[model samples]
Target: MLKRVERPVLKDIKDACVLMKDAAFPAPFDSRLEFSCSARGFWNIVHTGMLIPEIHQVYVCAQGCLRGVVLTAAEMNAIDRFSNIIIRENNILEGNNEDLIVEGMGEILSKLPYTPKAVLVYTSCIHHFIGCDLNLVYRRLREKYPDIEFTDCYMNPIMRKSGVTPDQLMRKQLYSLLDKQELDKKSVNIIGNNFATDDSSELVKIIRENGFTLREVPRTKTYKEYKDMGKAAINITYNPVAIEGGIYLENKLNQKHLYLPLSYGFDEIEKNLDILCENLGVQKIDFTENKKMATEAIINAKNIIGNTPIAIDYTLTIRPASLAKLLLQHGFNVVSLYVDSFIADEEDDVKWLKENYPDIKVYSTMHVKMRFVDRHSEQKILALGQKAAYFTGSNNFVNVVESGGMYGFDGIVKLCDLMIDAFLNEKDAKKLIQYKGLGCENYDTNCK
Candidate 1:
């Protein structure tokens, strides 16, 4: 049985509030778990590098470590581009694995019908533990294939505690092949997620109005196009994980960048837009129509939802606190939050929620104790995010795989529409959780 813990409202949390890394509740609730969310997998980050058309990847790790990504690649139909160098126990002890990686990559490249312009040698956590010299292997591969560029991409989970996480390091490594080029002041690069920003996003409009060409890694088809992304004068990063890469480009290539953390709150989104317009020196576009539509949609959903407790799960979003703030602002009774840790920028939202909506209890899907969460809330609640639906036992739930291309005011409108649909239609929660990709919860199965 799961027991809820009680704590003071945000104002009473402390006279001088200090941001704590762990959950507000103590013990098992605060302890983190490895419970995997069906919402995402390891390959989400892997494909960010491998999806490049002209690039081949060599994943050098143990067979056990290789299985998940191998299965995922096959599932995604991207198996043809991957070759693995499985490390054995003996190899780790003996420590001369550079030859294996270099030889394996060479053989894979030789057999390929289409010659690759670049090869990424991805090493796992075991290599770091054994202190395997991947740099040497990368250098050897570069020497062997002078025409093909080789980069050292790491999958080392051990270094995750470092200020720059493995994902952050990997995003930075994606731009390693980009050499300094003549700047294109009229061009802008969105260096971040594999997902494309919503075409209706204000950010997209601002870029176009300024007459700047937009470039994103996922949208690039050829090696030349990928390389040309470096030519952009500005980089606007949506996710914080990609901020390090933006900084690297700025310092190394003299490319200026603006880091806009993803936010679900309308106010925060508008504020981000203001900063974006100011940074790009573009006229701020009006979002009144979008705002009006979103407000109307929210009202319609709220009329049907009434006072039903809504649980917003963190797995469905990169910014759960911001989303919760948005929901609360719309007169929704957000009674439960399922989140693990808060990012630095989320502190303000967290504090505000504590101060204002203190009745909302916080839960952790990643908590080790969640294994014992058998009791569902008595309230006939509506859940947002797949994990929230799972834990809360809510029939009326919004199931989303990530943000589902949701951004800006347009996203808010779509979200309200989804909420209304969930309330009216009783979709099987099990089937919805199993479904993947953008708008997976919707009737349309063709969405990628």
Candidate 2:
């Protein structure tokens, strides 16, 4: 069973204020009194991150408040330079005015000579209050337009702190397609590639080498191809954020769902290989050559940084866990682990850690107090998303903020090299130290 972390309570008002300041803006308002002013305000924030890509087209259909405006900005930021087009719908509100939204969609649909690959309809908080069933709206639109794929993004504008994350929204959209696919017994589905760090090509190579056929679901997969997904023998979930869809697939197809951590470490790769071999009933590859390569690499790495103490704070729990296991095997003292969250079959991992390295400590963000241990640790390894990297003050250590996908034997070597570099470089070490408020200048400071 996976260990669960309790949520933290807020005690610092100043920290609360800082969180609010950093939070994304609330969705737009549609009242006559605030119409012009709200539009200007929304546009300013929108312009900061909005981009028109050429591959996909976005047509904003806002209802209630200006939630559509806020969502459009975020979507635009996510798709920058991806070759997509974004066009705003003229009728942005539907009070008792459903016709406005309908007509606006019609106008946009008519203007396009060819139906787009996908059509996303965004809704505000008002739409939810008014009981607008976007699923119904999408079904209706699909029946009328037949040629285009339709989806909806629910952006609740009223609750400042309750909006759906971009990741959640994207998963919701993708689930719609995954639900329609037929199950195959020999094929395997790959979940958790958000186009952010999903190196699909490399993943495919690894999966193929392990003797399983791979299918990836994205905008690129055709409707027919996606519908045939029910055939996969099993589903390998790489990212926790993608678990929602995996759950759906399990229920619908009765396919086995295995959650694996994404990391640039040999142990993780070995675990993944083990899972594939077991599921497919295939013989394990003689890892004699691969193991030798990995062993030699670690031996070389340890010579440069023997017995160094390292700390890791990452958005994904699997990354830290996998990387920590690798480093520990290479003679590093993994003092403290700070994880954002953990979602997987942790039976093996927990057992392995307890039986072999019982002294290593793991903490979730809620219970983490990094300053207490920073003085004792010689270096830190921060394998996190950009946001978490900045939040953890890892810039003071020899840190590497990688957004690209890392997997297989080659990836493990690269991760080991990064750790070695971090251990040896004073500049990198000092940067991380300052970021975490562990510099000599603040040696007496208490973070609590």
Candidate 3:
């Protein structure tokens, strides 16, 4: 007969806090109390920031249970450059190879002269089904090598729910480090340093000029360095995913946090600067020159395009929405917006669109179909990711995927020039037509 034991709810919380306090830094904020009415949501959010970055070297072990290859790809891309060694145990092509895989990984990791900062053991479906006790393995490994940091990435690939994925998992790891540290008054941590289009280094340079020290969580050197995050007066989260970590920091370290929209256009950059000045109690410097250059570039592009209908499909809704807003301001009609459903974290974006431009159409991946594309208007500007670019093709459409870092004033000018050129040239239009299979088979059509 199987024995059933009642689980202690508060015990997990207390134990997590104690363990984290010893292994990491105590969050400056009071984590004992709950913030939201929803206990489950609050705990999940708290659990999100459960790993530290200062632990030197890290070992990534997969138990072969992840559902999305994209999740692993994102994690690998994010951590690959962090001066750490990532070792994958379970092979995607080779199934039921957990023991052999784990053994091989163990051998390789054990061969290292010094202990790793952390060992992040990630599980896919195969290991989850086999009911592998990663905690036990972690404990056993710790016994053999007492100095290494150890943790589990208990991500179920089949779990298609929001707030779960490699992205969230990685964020949790960052949070754990924050919990283990002491606060730094002059220092601030940069969250959301992922493999996405986020250019944090450039932003850090701008912030440093404003007289603040910035520490990127992904670039931490030691556990002591991780603890120093608690001393920061505030945290500036660049992305929505980063917000969760900021919230954790605010709750634990009692640090003030402000969520700045991802810096794309000149306006966004100015707003970011304004917020920094206001919070840091520094004088706001004028970015008027940058703003003027951006505005002029946008205006020039608009004059060339002359009311061309543009369509944008992007991985995240914010980028497309911002692009749509910019294009609309410069006289282009954003007829269609294609976005991934996962990106919509708040309805404020939808509300903003409704208030400013009700005529523009927005389509999520869930509702998009072939009919939508067939009914597109003329002179389309397809701003999309690699995947979205591959699927979309039209005679009136110009794929503007290579605009290169569509952020800041310089990016605006480059994108505007491309759009202007695409709209004015008959040869460019013909090329687009041929690319989309809308022109003659031999590419003989003038398209004018």
Candidate 4:
């Protein structure tokens, strides 16, 4: 039987505030050893950033490091696009592993049935420790494959917290491939997250009304289409990770960028839309109708979930604190939250929640105490995100895997629908949390 955890009661939202303010939550606990119930969300980001249709990959890493990704590639049916060069122990100690990598690249280009437009070479954390000079290896590969683009991708999990994460660094490298082109003030590029925004997005409607074309990498069908994104005059980033890429484009290509971070609060969303319009020099498009629809959805959900205690997790959205604040404003009883860390950009939301809703409890997923099941609290309730459902014993939960296809007014509406559905339905949250389902159809990689 699974063990229950002791509910860490906060004196109020003020005590919850100390959790993020001073990092007093938990000790360093590794979650990799735990069996992952769902990796579909993470693979979505990988496919979005790494799996360019015309670009092939050559992954250099230890056999152990390659096992999971290799399996993932096979599952996605994208095995043909992936190649690996196993790094031996001697290679790391003696240095000079260029020959192995060059040989792998050469084998792929010469033997592949079709030509690849580019080749992305990835190295694991072993290189971080041994300091493998990849620049020289890249130069050699460039000489050998002058017709194809070569990019150095890193898969370093060790530096996830210390520096720009693998995802953030990958964003910078992806945009660096865009060749300089003539600016198009009528065009806009969506950077950062791989998922394309739904058509109902107010931001999309506003851009279309202004006669601007939206360019998103995931929606681009070909390599040429992806490259054409460089011509965009404005880069609008939805996720914080993509801000680094936007900054790079501004510095390197002189492209203008507007950061439109996703928000659940209607007022904040309106403010973000205003900022976007100002940056693009487009007239403020009226969002009153969409706002009303979103407001109605929220009201309907609130009516069904009146005073029901809730738990939210960071995996559902980027700004958990912001979402919690919004929920509290609507009179939702958010009894607990499961968050590993506070995102630097959303610190203000955390502060606001601290001051306003001081009664909500906070739990750290990575706390040393979390290693052992605390057979204590039996508070079953509605939850958002899989992790939150598990920790709170919530049977009614919204299983939003990632921030894909979620943004603007449409995002708000969909979230409201999910919350309502969870309230109306009876679900086995424990079973849902443990099921290791197949990859999502949108990002399936079927490799033999």
Clashes of each: 2, 22, 35, 11
Q: Sort by TM-score, best first: what order? A: 4, 1, 3, 2
10 residues in a row with least lDDT, candidate 3:
37-46
RMSD list, candidates in order: 6.1, 12.8, 16.1, 4.7
lDDT of 2 at 59: 35
Q: Enumerate residue pairs that collide in model 1.
A: 10-354, 10-355
lDDT of 3 at 212: 77
44-103 per-residue lDDT for model 2 (tens digits): 212211111112334333333454443443433432211222223433343432544455
Candidate 3: count of backbone clashes, pairs at least 3 residues apart or interchain: 35
Report the CA-based lDDT of candidate 4 relative to the real structure.
Answer: 0.73
* Candidate 1 residue-wise lDDT at 252: 88
How much is 420 displaced in model 2, in angstroms? 4.0
Model 4: per-residue lDDT, tens digit, 1-448? 9999765743333322233334332321234333232323343324544435588877899998887677656655677888888999887777758777888778778888888888877788887787777888899998988899898887788866677888788877777678888999999988876566766788887888789989877677788888999999989887888888999999888889888888887777999999988887878868888888887888888998888878888778887888888788878888777776666756777777767776666766654444443423565488888777765656788876555567877788889899889988967666555432223332433111
Badly placed stretches (over 4 Å) of model 4 are 1-40, 374-380, 426-448
Ranking by lDDT: 1, 4, 3, 2
Worst 10 residues of 4 by lDDT: 439-448
Off by over 4 Å in 2: 1-94, 97-100, 111-114, 156-169, 178-186, 195-206, 210-212, 218-233, 252-256, 261-272, 305-309, 333-336, 344-403, 408-410, 421-448
lDDT of 2: 0.47
Per-residue error for 412 in candidate 4, Å, reads 1.3
Model 1 spans > 4 angstroms off = 1-33, 37-43, 375-380, 435-448
